[model samples]
Target: MYENCLKGHSALVTGSARRLGRAVALELARAGADVIIHCNSSKAEAEAVKKEAIALGVDATVLSADFSVDGGAEGLIEAAFEVAPDLNLLVNSASVFPSNRLAEVTLGDINSNVLVNAWAPFVLSRSFAARAKSGSIVNMLDSRITDFDHSHAAYHMSKHMLALLTRLSAMEFAPSVAVNGVAPGLVLPPVDMDAKGGAADAQYLAGMASGLPLKKHGEPEDVAKAVLFLLASSFITGQIIYVDGGRHIRGGE
Candidate 1:
């Protein structure tokens, strides 16, 4: 359904190496949008995504950055424009999920989470709006932001901040730039886990699914579909699409 929907447009999907981010980028390419794949330390995987996008008949490139570094978003925005002068979509999908209870969370953990998950996306959205004639943004979030995750104190806090940022940027960038968010639950294994979908990770998700409304986990493509919907939308902004199979609304997801 998205074929030629985004023809002539361009996008940048941060952390578009091998997980949910990669799925989002590939979907954009399938819709005929040239894309810049952003990564922190997944160059080889990012390159593979770029090749996949290129195979889909759209321009693709990789831009890496250390999002924890101050002002890092500025360079990413610069490179996005350079790679695709008509860059119009920014997908803030790169994030770090650290497990730490509130009592045990360290200053560094808080700092890192806030910088990459919250600050980087905020800065990139601001800059993208400043330069683009018209475009859209999609920030990746966790469904737990609506409730809470005691085991992921810093991560949850940063996601809450990003949710607010999405609303603020949507209000601020109105009439020109559209800002939105996609919150996923039990979609992919954490970066620290066996990304190859090992037995342990599958068992964990299988167990996690038992508590969700759908009684099952979601796929990266689910979130990617939500992103594409938001991008194709013209009257939607300051909104969030949760790809958690009713988990966010039904509770116990």
Candidate 2:
């Protein structure tokens, strides 16, 4: 369905070295777009993804930057433009997921979460909108933004603000660029998750999905497909597509 829609288009995907970010980057390359894969410390994995993209006959570049600092997001954007000045798509998929209950959360935790998950996407979106010829931006959000996750209070709040930013940016950058978000539920857990933690998260997500009409957990590609739709659709903007196996409809059931 995305054939030739992205031909000759250039895309920059932040935190795209592995997992969902890598999946999205490869998917875009498969659809005929040159890709800039951004990573923090996954240089080898990023290069692997780049090789895969090159095998698909698309130009690929790997960029490394820590998006958790004050100026990291802008620096990433500037680096991307330096590689491909006429960039057409930006994917804000890089994020920091720290687990801390509200009672124990510190100012440092809150600031770090907000900077990486919320503010970085906002700054990168604004930067892309200003320089893009005709561009689209997809922000990676979490379904937990709607339902409270007590263990990840700060992270949840940061994603909540990102959802708002997606809407407001859609209005602010309208008629020039399209801004939208994809909120994925239980696609992939953090790399550091232990067996117990992974199983617990999986069970929780499965329980949530059981009440949904789809009755299944989602995959990263499911989210990527929704993103490709947004990029291809000429009229869609300022929207949040939940690729969560309909879990959002359960309303925390």
Candidate 3:
């Protein structure tokens, strides 16, 4: 909505290869921000998104890092600064969601989920604060943080950790960097739910949305708009905008 509001900013959006991350990167580019798209192994997809962002009339590039590894987050931040030293915006949009109930969740599952979903974002945020003089950070969170997702116990725990990090980081980075989050519910189906060589079933998604208070699911644009809104503002900090069509209010499983 705020056209060219981020004209001079440079952004690094993790997991920008596809889905919501792709939407956020393109949206930022539309607002005139130079974008660096990051992906774990989807360099091809990231390159395509880069083309889209460049077509938006802003400088764009692609970077890759494995958040599952030890130095991945730190390395990614270093790489981002190498490309855009004036970088000022960071969006922690990459995450891994595993489907395992609490009773069935293994230590390995917890370790992997937390590494990518929580630990990496923390490392990235810390690295960003240390390098940038002033900027904004938005961590993508799940609306399910307020409730239990019995089928995604590991993922749920990781998001809750991230939610805490968002608030604490805001206070820590205050008066210089604004730290906030966007919690989305049912905006897109989980990657694991996708059928072989196809997207997730539309009918299944529609059925899922019927339980939400709005009785409908949201689009990527809805979440992107929230991210842009947070990035455009200098006053708002430590707040989480829910783009979940009020599903968070119901605290569904």
Candidate 4:
């Protein structure tokens, strides 16, 4: 579907060393965009992704930035522009997914989550919008922002703010650039669960999928395709596409 729409375009995908971020970066490269893959610590994985992108016949580079600290977002964007001076697309896919009940959440947890999940995206979007000749931005959000995930209060609240940032940046950027978001549900479990070989987590996700209107769990590819649509649709902006197996309509699961 992308075809030559993204040919010669340059994109930056934050937290792109692995998981959904890596998936999105590779998809963009396959669609003909040169990619800059940013990671905080996964240098080896980032290089592997870079090789994959290069195999697609597009320029690919890896950059590392710790978005939890001050000036990290600016440095990431700067590094992207250094790789491709005419950068035109940015995906704010890096985030902190900390699960904690309200009573147990510490101030440090709240600050770190907000800084990485909400503040980094907003700051990066603002920086890109300011200097972009003509570009589009897509923010990665969670479906839980619409419904509450009690155990993940801090993460959900930060994403809720990010959803708002997506809309506001769309308006703020205006005719020069477009801003949008993709709110995904159950595409992949949290990294911790994935690491533990947690069959129960998989079962729970499958059960949730059965409840969805689509009767299936989504994959990163679903969100990637939606992102390509937004990037190509010149008339669309300030929109949030829920690639969540219609779970948003069901209110959860």
Give the count of colliding residue pairs in each prediction: 0, 0, 0, 0
- Model 4 C-alpha lDDT per residue in residues 1-253, reported as the tens digit of each score: 5776799899999999998899899889989999999999999999999999999999999999999888999898887787898999999999987679888988888888889998999888888888889999999998887777888878877888899999999998999999999988878867655434468767867877888888988888888888888877888999999989887888852
Q: What is the Cα root-mean-square deviation between model 1 and the actual structure?
A: 1.5
Best lDDT among the predictions, by candidate number: 3
Q: How close is candidate 3 to the true structure, as a TM-score?
A: 0.97
RMSD of each: 1.5, 2.2, 1.4, 1.6
Q: Which model is ahead, 3 or 4, in terms of TM-score?
A: 3
Regions of model 3 farther than 4 Å from truth: 196-200
lDDT of 3 by residue, 1-253 (tens): 6899999999999999999999999999999999999999999999999999999999999999999988999999999999999999999999998799999989999999999999999999999998899999999998998878889999999999999999999999888999999999887777788544324456666888999989998989899999999999989999999999888899886
Q: Given candidate 2, what's the lDDT at residue 233?
A: 78
Off by over 4 Å in 4: 194-204
Which regions of candidate 1 are displaced past 4 Å?
Answer: 194-196
Candidates' C-alpha lDDT: 0.90, 0.88, 0.94, 0.87
TM-score of each: 0.95, 0.93, 0.97, 0.95
Ten consecutive residues with minimal summed lDDT in candidate 4?
189-198
State, as a TM-score between 0 and 1, how close model 2 is to the true structure.
Answer: 0.93
lDDT of 2 by residue, 1-253 (tens): 6886799899999889988899999989989999999999999999999999999999999988887766888899999999999898999999888889999999998899999998999999999999997889999998877677887888988999999999999999999899999998867655545536667878866765567678877778988888888887789899999987765776652
Q: On a 0 to 100 scale, what is the lDDT of residue 249 in model 3? A: 90
